[model samples]
Target chain A: MPQVTLTVNGKSHTVEVEGRTLLVELLREKLGLTGTHVGCDTSQCGACTVHLNGTSVKSCTTLALQADGGVVTTIEGLAAADGTLHPMQEAFREHHALQCGFCTPGMVMSAVDLVNSNPQGLSESDIRHGLEGNLCRCTGYHNIVKAVAAAWPVMHGKETVAAE
Target chain B: MYDFAYEKPTALAAAVASLAGDMDAKALAGGQTFIPVLKQRLNKPTTVVDLAALGLVGITVTADSVTIGAMTTHGEVALSAAVQKAIPALANLASMIGDWQVRHRGTIGGSLANNDPSACYPSAVLALGATIVTDRRSIAADDYFQGMFTTALEQGEIITKVIFPIPQKAAYQKFRNPASRYAMVGVFVAKTAAGVRVAVTGAAQGGVFRHAAFEAALSANFSPDAIAGIATSADDLNSDIHASAEYRAHLIGVMAKRAVAGT
Candidate 1:
């Protein structure tokens, strides 16, 4: 067993894991953060997306050892400490972005990272292109694109908050 | 994935030493492909050497060429302003690989080392006549790739960097598989001081190779119309469910023409 230390959601934890344990497994099984879904064990689906060192990566393919001494942020860590929703989450909720809610966490996480990367602003086509990695079979991605487009203004501080 | 001893060497020499000592050791770069292969149990190495800690990342641009480290991710290469200024076509090619998440994790070295037949990097490497720098020596791109899923790298030889000579004009056009996004037929055309080179990937059974007739036609006229009559034979090409060998051969001409016209 290897002892791996990582900071998740502004908290540090040292845990023991097998050499083959993936980062998603550690988050879901070890830390009890199950919001990160495993839609596809392969890297095709972006259901296991998480921010590793401030960049979004597929957690299902990342080894636990690879995240040692790194900062990780999952979907559970997105909201404020007082439970206020993130702008992206608020937009998703208001726009009815999810159907069964299976891929919302990964979708929101990847969207936040995408918004962070693009500080200027995101257009409708940009939102659609950025959502290519994430697959949502239920909603047909119409509301999802709308939600991401709505969050861009709030994320860039151009707007106060997402409208209800 | 089988349990194996993991080693993360901070220094390049130590990583190479650890790999040379164990016959069944595998060097892990970005792990974009290696991790999926391991999860499928396709490979079972006794030891997995993680090369993330090694300081083998960065891009250097000189007057005549650009040298990129092995650990540089596709995202980094695609976003690098220097790479974009020096070789916008290479940056465009890198940006079209996989997707946002895959680009963030996939490294150029791992992609080149794996040498997937449908990969986009090999065509650029072959057409540009780049040089692959290893710990021991430098190997030309012509000699680096041997076949599909094969390279000329010796046992335990580590690729440190890849040096690509700047061309007067170059462009790449790829027809992607909708599911996996791998190239079904990709063409890279470049006009350098030496001559015009045309390399094709994803359609060949023997891996990426230069198209001699296309090259000759382009060298003489440097236009899409020059090679409009030239058609590659389908006898030696790969035929899969996604595309037939004859279809791929047809796409080669189409893509090559598009590349020339774009450039």
Candidate 2:
């Protein structure tokens, strides 16, 4: 086993893993951070999404060893140290953005990344098109769009209305 | 995934040497397609060479062409100001590939190396008359692609970059598969100083290919009306659940018209 050092959330973790170990497997099996769910083994489903070096990437497709020098942020790290829900999480709850919630963690993580990077504004069509990579069987996408729009201000410190 | 030794080479020489040392070694690029297949045990290799550390990551624009490094992510290429200015069609094609996550991780080299029949990158190469640069040699687009999941790359050869000439005008149109987002039918058309080239993906049984008849028609008359009577036979086209060969043939014409009309 190759020893690998990676900064997850805010702490550093050193673990021995097979060189071929995937980042998703390391997060779920080794670190016990099961919030990032694996929907499709292929990179098709954005369910295994996480922020690697500040950009959203599907964890299953990213090898653990490749992230050796990179900092990774999972859903577990989204909350405040005092256990306060992130604004996106709060918005999702308020808007009923999830059904089974299997894809919520990844969805919220990706949404936060999207809104943070986009400062101009995101319309309903932009949110839907931006989150097209994520699939949700239960939510008909009405609330997911609402959650993203509602959380945009909290995440970006800006207020905007979604044009109906 | 099958157990295999993995090597992340920091240099191109190291990557090639690692592959040359192991007969059953495969270069791992984006891992968008290859990784899933590896996990499914469809491909079992003794060693895997990871190219992330090689520093082959940039988009360079020259006087008449653009050079994209092998390890350049689709997102980088799509959002690159240089690429957008020089060849907006390429940027548009990159943006439409798979989805955000896929674009974030998927590299052009990996997509070309894997050579999935439904992939989008190959059509760009064929249409723009790009050159596939390897550590060993440079290959023109016409000689690079062989068939499905095949390329002209020899063992241990690493693709360094792909050089695409700036086109007069070009556009790519794709009908996406709703589930996987693979192209149900993708067409790339480019008008260059040499001539007009038309390449189609997802609709072909072998892989991405140019349409000589359509190219000839466009070369004669650079208008949609020129290809009004041209017919794409279904002899070697793909026929699957997404689209029948006949339907794909019709799409070829429709997409060609749209591409020419800049719609």
Which candidate gets the maximum lDDT versus the true structure? 1
**lDDT (Cα, tens digit) per residue for candidate 2, span A62-120:** 88887887899999999999998888998898899999999998899889888987888
| Candidate 1 lDDT over residue span A1-164, tens digit each | 89899999999999999889999999999999999999988898899999999988999989999999999999999999999999999999989999999888899989999999989888888888787889888999999999988888898888876244
Per-residue error for A94 in candidate 2, Å, reads 1.6
Clashing pairs in 2: none
Which ten-residue region of model 2 chain B has the weakest summed lDDT?
B254-263
Q: What would you estimate as the lDDT of candidate 1?
A: 0.92
Task: Give me the runs in candidate 2 sitting further than 4 Å from their true place.
Answer: A159-164
RMSD of each: 1.0, 2.2
Measured against the true two-chain complex, the DockQ scores of the candidates, in the order shown, are 0.81, 0.72
Q: Which regions of candidate 1 deviate over 4 angstroms? A: none
Q: Which docking category, incorrect, acceptable, medium or high, applies to candidate 2? A: medium
lDDT of 1 by residue, B39-121 (tens): 99999988999988888899999989999999999999999999999988899899889878888889899888899999999
Please provide TM-scores, in order, for all candidate models, with all chains considered together: 0.98, 0.97
- How close to the true structure is residue B221 of candidate 2, measured as C-alpha lDDT? 91
